[model samples]
Target chain A: MSRETILASIRAALPPGQALPELDNFGLHYDDPIQQFITTAEAVGANLQSVDNRGGIAAAVQAFLPGASSILSHVPEVPCKNFTRDADRDPHAYSDLDLIVVEGLIPVAENAAIWVPDSQYDDHAAMVLTQHQVIIVRASDLVDHMHQAYAKVAAAEVPRFGFFLSGPTKTADIEQSLVLGAQGTRSLLIIMIRDESTSTI
Target chain B: MIDHAQHARNFTANAERTAWHDDALWFVREKRDKATKLIPEWEELREQASQVKMHMLSRLDHYLEEFERNATARGIQVHWAEDADAHNRIVHAILERKGVKNIVKSKSMLTEECHLNPYLAERGMDVIDTDLGERIVQMRNEPPSHLVMPAIHIKKAEIGDLFHEQLGTDAGADDPKYLTEAARQHLRPKYLEADAGITGVNFAIADTGGIVVCTNEGNADLGTSLPPIQIHCMGMEKLLPRLEHLGVFTRLLARSATGQPITTFTSHFHGPKPGGEMHVVIVNNGRSAILAKPEFRRSLSCIRCAACLNTCPIYRRSGGYSYGSVVPGPIGSVLSPAMDLEKYAALPFASTLCGSCTDVCPVKIDLHDQLLAWRKYVVKEGYLDKGKARQMKMAGKLLSSPTLYRTASFLSKGMKLVPRVLLYNKKNKWGMERELPLPAKRRFRDLYRKRPRS
Candidate 1:
């Protein structure tokens, strides 16, 4: 078989195996991870909002994204007519969506990336097809760096598909000039709920 | 094979374009330095990344097998290709079996190496490159100038002309945002209509049997998410032992490439989405030959960050097309010779032996040292030009014997008194671009002998 032949060639060429390096605390630690998260996220061209409680989230969304014609969110507090979880629908149907809000399971401080499990999202296409994406996470959920973020994912059975999204889709392909929206969400809004009681409520 | 010096001469003829190219790449290098400076453990991370690659290459067969088994169990069809020909044929067979006509592709340097686009197009398949930069160069029918920034050599004005002719934009619309938007409009329907999507894998996790594809634009996601059939091609060296290893690579990749903390989309695909069918092709393509050489084995550690390309002085001045290979700059100078020494013999000579590439490498590949090694090997293989070899031989003989060296020095001094036309003839190539310095009337040895006691 071709597989056997390729593997044999690889085996023949290999030198003695070396031990894998430890990947623990591989970078600087932050005194306040949330502050670092906000600074890093903003640096990458993401807008942020700290909602006092879950009740104010919808109002904050209205205030932030007033131009959104259509809004879709799985969050119970925020009202949306077009929910992503509606069953037996084509994924491409979400292509015209103006806004889609989802909850972030974990946040990393070093880069303002949110860990969104595939299971939580009704369709992964929602994250990419929309004009703008809003990810809501508790301020306390932010970790110091990628190492800690991976520890959280490795501790449990990670979903079949997940991603660490930092900001809106962007490209520098034209002339190496950074452009915010290029085929994906134009803007990323992070609503970090500081009140612990409203994180789950 | 084309001579690198001749090819570079064509690129450097336009002094303004060369300066633009140099400044553009240097700007990326500065951004990389700034991004890396923020992390205190940047050096430690590079060391760790290097070790990970070395360890993986040592047990490559084992990890590939583990990854194959796990990926197969997850219902992803895994195929193996011994070389570029086999890789192209395998992808063709897959598309033929599925009766797919239109193919949408993201930025996969592997596909470029295999020349998959022309191969499929010859078979009456429409292959559309979805990445904006890739699309621009594809329309022009030219290979990518740089790995990360494909159209770096082409100016915005040229792109505006290309887009104007191809996409029917304004006669001279050169704005990056406007050009990008025009491309987005042009490519959206292609994405929805593509029968299959092919992507290059950034990292293949053995433990999870999944592949990670990172892109600044969400084109890869759109290409894979909407299509019914997805094909991913990756070099065997892209494997990692576990998913956690992704954390380390992810942190290092974007920061080193374009100075972003992370790419906009770091999508991880464990298997085909919903009802789609996914296939992963693992290509050897001379990678095993690299692994066999102990001295040059560290070249396998490259993560395709192109940090070396951004920082290389020779690459900046000469432009990427100067090197007669798809991959250019310092890393390509080291790698291309390993593949075809005769064809790429001039690449090793293209560098200034500056250590800037090594300093900025995320994997610590010792790029400059490898480049120097390639120079020695290429010369030993008798691939050097005959005239240059004769000159070196004569210079060697003259330097080894003191009597001959003194005679040559004395003769050279006398030649300065001769007419400039006699010495600055066509036989003397060095005098073409520069003037020869005047020789002193007194020899250093005679002057020292006659000097008064200090």
Candidate 2:
């Protein structure tokens, strides 16, 4: 009954429809998108690292967070001693995780955001519950803007959920002071793999 | 009647705090300017975003139905609420059926509008606000001042005292990083223990049957991901026609909000996670009435970026609490009066009609024009105070009659000879905080008559 009432009211309030604007030329592009991505990513407080292949991710992770004790790695290239993917396990089980390494699908150069779908991991909480996060994105998978990134997302298989993660969990709530790791991941590291053949990682 | 001027006077009484607040907001506005400058197509993007919103408003019914169908097909439960009470009841009913005890909420202004936390708390449900700023305010038992930076009104030292009292932090520990870490430690358990998660919708895509929530702290994701049940409360106006529109809105949102390239997490939820339940509560709550008024309809297009609040000179100086509403800026001034004309009639007069808010609005809502329109409606509806109404009527008559205006102008030149006490007495409201300008040596009419003809 409320549904019908709301819909009727909306219809009654409707005015003559206007045309939606074309978004063909809405987004901006840089001459060097990767360089722009690095600059923007660092500005947002994300650490950037260049890895040659999937094998180098382990070394890079160790170098980035040497003291990480409890690790959760969704990427098979980077094995962890702490925990493995368990679909039925309670998400709270990953609450004490020190680091989480997952693969990013597409990286947007404009905002330095990496698209990570739910299908990439068994538990969604692992992405944000950890102290530090490492997202492995291919250099070739970088797009110029969100428009291009969304195009890729629209074309891909629809996940139940996904996100364009730009940086670590941060907040400027108290006196507009930028504080990283406010309620979630304390730090974010993007490992850009330049080797094209290492896609399966 | 809600006296905004009196409340503003209370806030401005502390001159030092007022200047600090003004400088803080101006700093954010400058950051916004710098961020937007990076994109060469920024103005065009705003135009495209505004047109898209207008188009969506025109066919709102069609899109709402489309969104409901697509979302329901994806196994997300869809519910509609005719008003705020209905919204609170629907959410409570869902949580009640699930036997949820403890709940965590992200920064959803709709819930704040509905007073959902108190409603649920009265029924013995424990509701925790998970956003750091929101948590701080919740602890202090206050409402958010600004939309984006909720705790911007409270200084670091106050927060330090609050944390020391609530979370047992060291005394005099006023560093933002330390206070934020204390909040992080305190809220993580709430997220882990929450039986349900409630979040506000940033944008809902009709074509994709999903909603996008943007946050820097990722609390929304954490709260919703672990909970067995998740509820997303959204105003009907948040609907977008397609997923591509997100590309446009997401680009403009953070740049306009906090001057970030983007919020850290732009999470998209198509439906519930595996073995988890998700519900979308679409609440009307005076929005349909707003849509019916062509003059005020564009106010519904706001994305809650708080750019208008940051750029508004009055908001900067007077602070958000002075507005006496859930939202407290130029957009709030226009929207609040429409909710209750008699109670909020004074809100429209709170601004200087500077139009800075209009220039910075991502959706290009004519905020100052709407304020002016609301003032006309307020006067026509006889909501203005009796004394002000009589003075305005007298001024109107004098301005319409050239002879009366000229006579008054001529007589007013003699006011310089009068003592300041007689001129700035209780009858002169304008002279309360301002000085009357000195009269010209000769009348403007005489000077114009003697001017050399070009």
Candidate 3:
């Protein structure tokens, strides 16, 4: 077979979705970093010190969450692992906390905002924001953020999608009327966590 | 069809476009440097971003399944499409069910991958591009040459002329603000009258079934907020593991893309509006196949920030249309081959292997390396012109063996016939536009041997 046809056949065979199969799913469900933080943070419910990756909201809760709670946070970055690590490939490579504000407890940006996790791989390494002052936001805020994002992308161009998701940029290119959110990412959520160590300040 | 062969011709032939391409990309490179150089921790951040994408890609299946379950629980319908046709059919079928012919849309590359707007238009629905730059290119019936700045290839006066012809602007009005206002006024009616809104997802959080989009223009708010039905198209690779990582990305994205401290607006989403219907389409296209290749997986880490486009020397010269896809520049080179290698056979070779693009890329994709990899693929695919193939094989054979190489080098010492027809004539793409170098009468190897034996 022609190499072109062979490659296309292989491309055709692969399944499409959000994540690759078999790499992360052993069908084994376990509490990852976010899950563990969620379990521990909710147990304390007020001011609590976290081991790592759980400070942005722990501090926010101490400051606001209905109770007079104290502050505690951990230095999120630990010692490096035993691999050949380079920080150049992926910058947002750090493992971070999942933050949430049930009653809009933390003020991040002007609106409710949640921190996004970073990526890591062979080409790029992650940049862990050490002891970062993270934001905690409401679930509702994520919805609002998505709606706005949807509109921005809908109006964008398709070819420019590589440049920042251009297909979402809504334009009257097909017709002479203005449209919104044609690209369709609906909301954003920001979770704030405060490790008790940072809260000590 | 993109009519890629023909469009590619238009892109390379336009000298003005070439100049605009250079200046436009240079401006992007400058912006990327401003973003990356600012943080002493910038290199570290790129690594983090790449690793995060890799991990997300690694666990992509689980996260997508998790997302589908959660999104469905939250009343959002999730659909899987393996290709552009499937994605378009699903979206069109959904819109047909709603009986909505007029729809407002934000930017979405997936739809472009599916050619969704045109597909819908063929069905008689009206789709509007909400972003100002998108609107400009859409109106001109031209593909955007650059990713971030859509009309970066278009001069403001040309836009004025286009608006004057299409939108009825006053004959000498060339003001950016004035023209912008005209477009806004012209498009406001669609936002209100449209029945559904379409958008593209910048980042999809599988953990929480959420999305994040950042924009300088506030058009996204106008597109989705004023519409009742919303559909979001997300490339499967656009997944993130957590929300905390957003802080790192938002800090780096706009600064790298356009030199802004941050995009004027960055929004996140979890579900539908209180009363609206929400649909999410996850598209694979060639992503799964791409992920399987260890060398090529890093291409998926692209944040769609177009920083590399700005720094690419060849891209500045040939422009985006030469690549013949919606996504252009360095990312486009990596992506196009995955989608359809034969069609984009020329794209990988378009680069000069300058590597400046890789240096400026925010996520630090080894773009030049990818381009080099593509060259091998094209040759192996048998897509290269036979004459070129023959020449390459002959050269390879000659160089790989010292005797053949020495014989060829000896033969070329006094040979004037080779240069006149082989490399310096109209038949060669390189010689078509630039001056062909005159071949030296004596070979450098022969002259060095004749010198002293030091």
The numbered model that scores best in DockQ is: 2
Predicted candidate 3 versus true structure: per-residue lDDT over B173-248, tens digit per residue: 7777567668766876676677888888887766566666666444554555545577889888888776545645
TM-score rank order: 2, 1, 3
Compared with the true structure, what per-residue lDDT tens digits does model 3 show for residues A1-201?
222332343445333333322211112222243443343233212122223334344443444332322111222221122223442322222222121122222222211222222211111011111111222323222222222332333343211011121111223222222233222221112243334344321
- Runs of candidate 1 exceeding 4 Å displacement: A82-84, B402-454
Model 2 per-residue lDDT tens digits across residues B44-140: 8899999999999999999999999999999999999999999999999999998999999999989988999999999999999988889989999
lDDT of each: 0.87, 0.91, 0.59
Local accuracy of candidate 1 as per-residue lDDT tens digits, A76-124? 8777755446745687787788998889988999999889887666887
Which residue pairs collide, candidate 2? none
Report chain A TM-scores, every model: 0.94, 0.95, 0.20
Best-performing candidate as measured by TM-score: 2
Off by over 4 Å in 3: A1-201, B1-17, B410-423, B427-454
All candidates' chain B TM-scores are 0.93, 0.98, 0.91
For model 1, chain A alone compared with the true chain A gives a TM-score of 0.94
Window of ten residues with lowest summed lDDT in model 3 chain B:
B1-10
CAPRI tier for the interface of model 3: incorrect
In model 2, the number of clashes is 0
